[model samples]
Target: MAKSNKKTKKADEDMSKKKAEESKVKVEAEISNDTADTEENSAKTSEVSVESLKSEIDQLNDKFLRLNAEYQNYRKRVEKEKNDIFKYGSEKLFVEMLPIMDNFERALSASEQENIESKVLDGIKMIKKSLDELFDRNGVKKIEAMGMPFDPIKHHAVMTVESEDENNDHVIEVFQDGYALNDKVIRPSMVKVSH
Candidate 1:
């Protein structure tokens, strides 16, 4: 009976040990599964964060490019305006000189028609030549209207004339000469267009 009791006690201890080991294995497996799930969640969160960061970077980059282009365009526009200011700076002074040139032309024509004294005519011619040279140096140019097509930009048609020799819309006669400074017309020619 004593021997049988000892064997029974030993068997009970062995069974308890086996059950504790199985319970420990189950707990360990549950802990490992939880760790794996946590790692997966962390990876997914990291991916989302990376994607969001990339999207933000792209938006900022696009905004920067647009602003840079706008700045470049503004700079170019300012440069062009500065250049134009320099080019047309003396336009007002040149415009004021047109009437004086017209007076000189009238004087020369009257002198020629009246058969003025040679010395007086020579003096007038010299003054006119000096004025012409001054105008040439200052980028002043005459708008040729005689025998050309009537251009509203450079010519102001005061009257229409019937002509057999000239084509329609052609300048038959120029009543007043036109002048331009640096390709910009300051005064338009008064002309008669052929009908």
Candidate 2:
């Protein structure tokens, strides 16, 4: 009976140890599950933050593109305005000088036709030469239209004459001398064309 009792006590102790081990394994599994859940939640929050940051970056990139386009358009508009200013800046001054040029031309024609004194004619010629020099210095140029092809851009045809020659479409006479400023025609030459 005493040996049986000792054997029974040993069996009870073994059963308790097995139960303790099983409880420990269960607790460890619960802890692992808790850690996995926390890690998963953290990863999801990080992904959300990354996505938000990417959205912000895209907004900034779009704004930058719009601003860049606006700046380019502004620059082009300013450049065109600058070019227009340069192209027509001297037009007023040129128009003011036309009367003086016409008077000089009339005087030259009168002097040649009326047999004016040599000294007076020479003086008038000197003045005319000085005017030519001034015009040349100011980017002004004279357009030659006599005996050349008639062009509406440089020559304004006043009358047309009938001719049988191959070059009949050319300018035969220039009634008014044309002037240009920097390759832009300020006035077209009044001409007569043979057709």
Candidate 3:
């Protein structure tokens, strides 16, 4: 009976030791699982942060592109406005000079009067030449309308003359001179076309 009691005690101790070891192993496994879950959560958070940063970058890039496009359009508009200002800035000045030009034309036509003296004619011719030189220096040019091909952009037909030639659909005469400023026609030539 004593031997049997000793054997049962040994068996109980062994079973207790086995149960303790199993409990330790279970605790360790739970800790490992918790660590793994924490690592997975950390990875997911990092991925979310990366996606957020990418979205912000995309938004910034879009804003940059929009601003760039707006700046480009603004530059173009400013350039076009500057060009228009330069082109039309002298319109009023040129308009005011028209009367002087008309007077010059009258003086030239009256120089053919019967009572005009030679010295007076020479003086008138010098004045007219000086006026023409001034006009040329100020970017003013006279349109060539007589004996040239008819161009609606530069010539206005006031009358039509009958002609037998087919090539007569052209300018035959200019009644009043036309002027241009820097290669741009300010006024079309008043012309008679042959037809």
Top model number, TM-score: 1
Say what the RMSD of model 2 is.
5.6
Residue-level lDDT of model 3, residues 1-195, one tens digit each, is 999999999999999999999999999999999999999999999999999999999999999999999999999999998986787667667757766786878876876665566887787778778878977777778899888989998999999989888868798888888888877788888999998
Model 1 root mean square deviation, Cα atoms: 3.7
Query: lDDT at 7 for candidate 3?
Result: 92
Q: State the weakest 10-residue window (summed lDDT) of model 2.
A: 90-99
Residue 140 local lDDT, model 1: 80
Give the per-residue Cα lDDT of candidate 3 at 193. Answer: 96
> Cα lDDT for residue 166, model 2?
89
Clashing pairs in 1: none
Select the stronger candidate by TM-score from 2 and 3: 3
List the lowest-lDDT window of 10 residues for candidate 1. 83-92
Q: What is the C-alpha lDDT of each candidate?
A: 0.89, 0.88, 0.85
lDDT per residue (tens digit) for residues 35-70 in model 1: 999999999999999999999999999999999999
Q: Is candidate 1 or candidate 2 better by lDDT?
A: 1
The collision pairs in model 3 are: none
Candidate 2 error regions (>4 Å): 1-63, 83-88
